[model samples]
Target chain A: MNAGHRSESVPNASRLRIAVLAGGVGGAKFVRGLRQVAPEATISVITNTGDDLWLAGVRVCPDLDSIMYALAGVNDAERGWGRAGESERVSAELAAYGAGWPWFTLGDLDLGTHLARTSWLREGATLTEATARLAARWDLGVSLLPMSDDPVETHVVTEQGTMHFEEWWVRHRAALPALAFEQVGADRARPTPSVLGALASADAVLLAPSNPVVSIGTILGVPGLRDAVVSSSARIVGVSPIIGGAAVRGMAAQCLAAVDVDVSAAAVARHYGARVDGGLLDGWLVDTVDSAVVPELDSEGMRAVARPLYLSSLEQSAAIARDALAVALG
Target chain B: MNAGHRSESVPNASRLRIAVLAGGVGGAKFVRGLRQVAPEATISVITNTGDDLWLAGVRVCPDLDSIMYALAGVNDAERGWGRAGESERVSAELAAYGAGWPWFTLGDLDLGTHLARTSWLREGATLTEATARLAARWDLGVSLLPMSDDPVETHVVTEQGTMHFEEWWVRHRAALPALAFEQVGADRARPTPSVLGALASADAVLLAPSNPVVSIGTILGVPGLRDAVVSSSARIVGVSPIIGGAAVRGMAAQCLAAVDVDVSAAAVARHYGARVDGGLLDGWLVDTVDSAVVPELDSEGMRAVARPLYLSSLEQSAAIARDALAVALG
Candidate 1:
């Protein structure tokens, strides 16, 4: 075994309550792999609702469902969005009614999630409750959670105008250069008790290869969340969403620039420097191509491990996860 | 013109700014026919929001959308509920999660309306504003007004337990014999000013063939809406939802029974009654089968007009509307 490998055996499946901070696409892929490798782990995903917006009155939680669908084994692998057999007739009708923001194809089946969540939220339920109810519907083995019960919108302050994350990402195709990334209502949003409790009790915390700026960043933006994760006994590890230089999906590079972080694995590690520096990462996993950044990441106090984080196959992805756990318990 | 028809040189279109008090299904169909006959004339449908409920946090307005879809030319003709070309994948998923009542089949596209309305309400918009925004999206020319912006739910007190209108309508299929009908929050629900204005400014007023006890009756149940309609200068007319001894749609007869009204068109007329001992109905239209009850209605101080009120076709429905107008004007 490598020097980073630990002597402690992995936690039992039924007793393990692993919490993951996730975005979409990359995160969903990693989650699928995680579920395959650790089927018994009671996974709790604190998803980024920053990308969530009221599009024509439906509470569209893209990231949450991406993970939910991945867990439910119904996610669309081709588009990397929505369910595999999803229909868009409802979305087309929504477009016809001039509800706008048609770039995001809300499939008819996917719309069920939004409709249920929206309805629950309207009936005095928090976003947390709505999300839990939706997750329960899919019989999702792991608990799915919104980072905060309160509204915390991710505003991409572009040169053109301050627009919602969906407007910036989907509608505008993230074409406009972002001036800054603002997490609106972050100060007021409280970290869900479940998220905090999971952090406190977790033996290991995994940061899925979600967008560091908008996805994971938004979750950390919830006032007490970052602190809770940092102060926890759980060893923190993150898989770089950036494989080499470009993001797997979304404008992660642009988001990194807006947040004043360099678009490199080493910079991402340093950005999430140490669990002590308001950064929740202690172990950082980078792709083989970005192995050159190991020295810099180690210099910043994170145990840097170079592994194939491309997640091209479920086995490859699980191997990388095993590597992350190894480094965390070194 | 027939002897019952009040022949005049009055331009039908000019005198057709019809204000309709409605619930769902039957009410919507009459409004549909009304729109077909007088598309150019301003039609303002004041729907009963007393039947409105926040299920799973989505603000579902059965009457509002029923009328809106009917006017927008997309109501489901066969099922007599929701929009045409609708999908219930969302409802199915909700059921799978053990979430909201699933019997109603809230269509995916239709759920979008509720989502948007609920989201707007979350962002601090009243039901009126949300409904206006929703109608604007459909580009509906007819003014669709909620009886009250405040939350007013229609509750059916049955032997088993009191349940929401949607629960009673959808879950039980109105099977439970209702002990009484209660419009919850009606005492607190003051009618919107727009409703009174529409009623006063309307050239003619029509009550769609909705249930007198729970549909139109629910709207009239709002604190001041019934009083405004009763006192309005506009000529009032009502089409019978009940033809012979059976209702065109829904459990209108059962609802009438709950309110101690008989199941005949004449009974419907008497339910509206004479305003001060004989005043509420200026004119009442009954089907050919109920012609025997017309003399009884006239004796009770209600102007009764016998016509073929079974609205089987667009043209036939408009003919009934014309006859009702003729009687009201006489």
Candidate 2:
């Protein structure tokens, strides 16, 4: 049942190849820290595209840009999304025109990325191609790959009606009680070749501490994606988005409730379940505050470690990434 | 044959309904001045759509925005286009992304218009519908109607090959030595109902001093558009873009050369010819420097007058508009 038993252990950072499934803000910060800890290691990020949407006729890939901006050092850490020194002139005008959600604003700089991506996509280039083109602008230490070239927009079913995940997350600020989460087109969407290749070639695959229901959940929801990760020779590890009994960031608690899952680190680890029993995680990383769950997870045939998961600073994030890699390599 | 033969003439500005054919900078300035002279009159501008193009996945109607911004008092007078207090943050990023034209930059506020328009278009709104939505944002005194809802992009045939009018004008600065100007969709592009209705109900139709070969030329090129103007009860008048054997603004001289027309006031009026001779204009306004052409135009059955053609001030432009109306209503 030990995932480490099948693969040759990549003991040194220089020889390591890690593939990560990530989303916005929280995921981006984690990847940034991962880069800090393993500067020489090859990191390929399979970014969640369920957050991608059409705003004012332009394609905005939220998760992909988050990782890109963070890695390029242009991301606004304080605001949590978008580039620093960003202006809202265009978004203000969009609001005036009654186009795009007034609540969910796109900065002028971020609009540039949307414009480029939309233009390329309209010109017959796939989402993966558009992603590569946008990523090329930055000296992002990691290669960014979209989960799929196909549209896989996450929609939330509220008691009233079905709305886009962004409308629920951004416009309502997750106030809407989601009855269910649906990745529309996930049934037909195949993970991009780059993503599959990254998984196949990886020495370790990590599920970043992003929203498990929409971000990491949507990526794994792709047709062949879950099978690729579960069957890959690489040791698969997942860092819990929950610390103690609360979400690290975003609306992970609300999301967990929508899917009838308890809001706790051990509960989420159990939700992903153990790979030997036909679930995702070979190892699970929980916060030190929830160390009680470590023994519970280990007893379930999954390697478990409790570490300080707060990404308060670069050093802390790097330490967490280092801890996660250690648990996977072990 | 005199245009003044039309039965009813509303001398009172408040009761007047004047329609004007217009393009970007020159036309916007002329219409602004026209509004000053007839502030109480209902002005309906039939804007040239020949300059509209898809840039970075958004429909950019250069002439329409120019007039809208100018009328709204948000125009950048120094730059001759776009809104004042503009920022190029979006454009700089666009250049880095290699999306839009490198030479022709769109300010952030201006991009808002393109985004709104493109969004509406993608949502099944016609160009006319989109223009109405955009114009509704500002208290632009005049009704802004596109020449046609159908695409009518002006293309320049050069010694090398055909290129978009904007590329020939903005990127090449009209230095490519245009051999001919072709309004690409003019043959199939019918005048919008609003534009035709504006002309049919107008007291007089004034031709703003925009480029003759591209702007006005392309508008008139629309199928049945010229017929609507000629047959309508409205007296048709044209303000010359030429002065003292040279173009008043833009590459009107180059555009004239491409069509083998001499760059002179008399030559331009003759190019339009007399309505009695089955041409577009019933009267013409020329700069005082070229007063010698007045007698020549009159003898050729065209009512012509000389005036200060410079739109240096609102007062000066108002004076020019008044004089041009006098010639048309004689």
Candidate 3:
């Protein structure tokens, strides 16, 4: 769809209340692009907190910090995470003292966010409230919400042992083959009120190009969150993290293999399944290289569109965001 | 007495099981010098923990760290506190996040120690065990023991309101007139077993040139610590922090005034009182500039000696330590 047609079909394009489900780096990048595509739209992000962990007594919410820093224009674009012009003196010191994961470097600036969050949390603020307090520091141009107020850590079961997802991903570099992924505490985890409200009132919902199993999958795993998204009247569109037959970033292929899923755009779409068949996705966005999967998605009762999904720059990301929004509108 | 005669009187001086009561910078410097003077002595330092507090969820034992870093040869000599080559990136970030006292800068390397201490404490280790664990990282020749394993935060009662001792000292620079200093939790805080053992079997006990009202006073306030020192068979000698009528460093003068004590070497020695008169000091060493007070201290039933007490260099500090040890031997 063209811009003119999109504006005509989506009457209040500038005022559209868009909600996004996101993970860390990829999710943050996609959300940044979405913000550029619809500058005036009310964007609410329900970010996955499964990757959150306490390091050196400081609560570190990787996904939440990534999104906040990206939107605040301080994210290290080159490293693709943490604050720009960051220093690791604290991390090095922590390592010297044998505190925190030596492999997982927490930048000085990034630690500031964790300390702030931990302080608030200790002062009796829930995770959601602490996130809101952290986000309030910058004019993020969108509302950031955690998937749940309660703790829900993602633990990857491997041949060695059940390790934290971060320990598996960062420390071991995911070299250890995972047996399964467990969202510890998710059974009792409930979506925050803001998350439910955003889903219930959103004009459209977009799933960023985050890891399907650990990111978006974890958000959906939050007891009531998936049901809310499924029941919302808004059309839900998902952008594939995989292009061709491999993950666009990180170790999504390893994650997919652990879940016994093929590392392909078609497999990911099918993993989300179809909203018509008691699943989540109304539309699935795939890269042009995976255009061949459109027919299979359509047969599965989900619309599939192919586009240049690689977000190398803001322009490219905005273009992809426009495509996802177009699919949601359709 | 001359050094040669003093050495004759104190046989096997190098092997003396000397225990020193200490606070932060001044105390650390004195302890470091004492180690240089008697490298083979079984030195046990009972460090003050009243200044210890939780900052950004990390336990910060200022006095213990100062002595540890000093003895480990990693202390910032110029600053007389914290680690050498330290960065304030984390502190700046913490300030930006509004997580800790803006006035008190926690160096990156110092923060690592806090992280380690906090981690150990969380894992059910007492402050003594945590200190031991932290000290194990470096070859600190002396055994460092916190005055008490239990928490004993010194809260300064100021006209404005009660504030943490650190806030009163670092933030206000002791400009806020303190009505009194309260060693909160000291009533239940017990000196660790090691502390008691060190005192009981000590050949000699030397008091570091630290604040008499807060540093040394707070340690003595720990329920049984003062009694242990009083009852110990070993001779107890104190090095006055006051030279002439002023503190050698920091706000000792202000602290002395708060307690309604004269800011003089004799007054402080008298404040500790004579061990014969139910006080804690057997002998007192004062700066040569305060020699006028020696006769008065002798009249008060406490042996007094005058020496050059300024520790501007290691040599000077070593000489001062020699004098203090001579007083203990006498």
lDDT (Cα, 0-100) at B89 in candidate 1: 78
Return the TM-score for each candidate structure.
Answer: 0.88, 0.95, 0.95
lDDT of 3 by residue, A1-330 (tens): 124334423346667999999999998889888877787788999999999998878889999999999888999999888899998887776787677778889888888888778878988889888888778778888899999999999999999999999999989989999999999999988999999999999999999999999999999999989989988899999999999998989989999999999999999988998999988899999999999989989899889999999989877887888889988986
Which residue runs of candidate 1 sit more than 4 Å off their true CA positions?
A1-19, A40-46, A100-102, A122-130, A137-145, A274-282, A295-301, B1-12, B35-40, B119-133, B136-142, B275-278
Clashing pairs in 3: none
Best DockQ among the predictions, by candidate number: 2
| lDDT digits (tens) for residues A268-325 of candidate 2 | 9888989989998999999999999888899998899988999898768777887788
What is the Cα-based lDDT of residue B287 in candidate 3? 92
Instruction: Name the fnat for model 3.
Output: 0.68
Candidates 1 and 2 compared: the better one by DockQ is 2
CAPRI category for model 1: acceptable
Chain B, candidate 1: TM-score: 0.92
Q: What TM-score would chain A of each candidate receive against the reference chain A?
A: 0.92, 0.95, 0.95
DockQ of each candidate, alpha-carbon based:
0.39, 0.79, 0.65
State residue B212's C-alpha deviation in candidate 2, in Å. 0.8
CAPRI verdict on model 2?
A: medium
Judged by whole-model lDDT over C-alpha atoms, candidate 2 comes out at 0.88
Instruction: Assess the local accuracy of residue A100 in candidate 2 as a C-alpha lDDT between 0 and 100.
Output: 76
Instruction: Point out the worst 10-residue segment of candidate 3 chain A by lDDT.
Output: A1-10
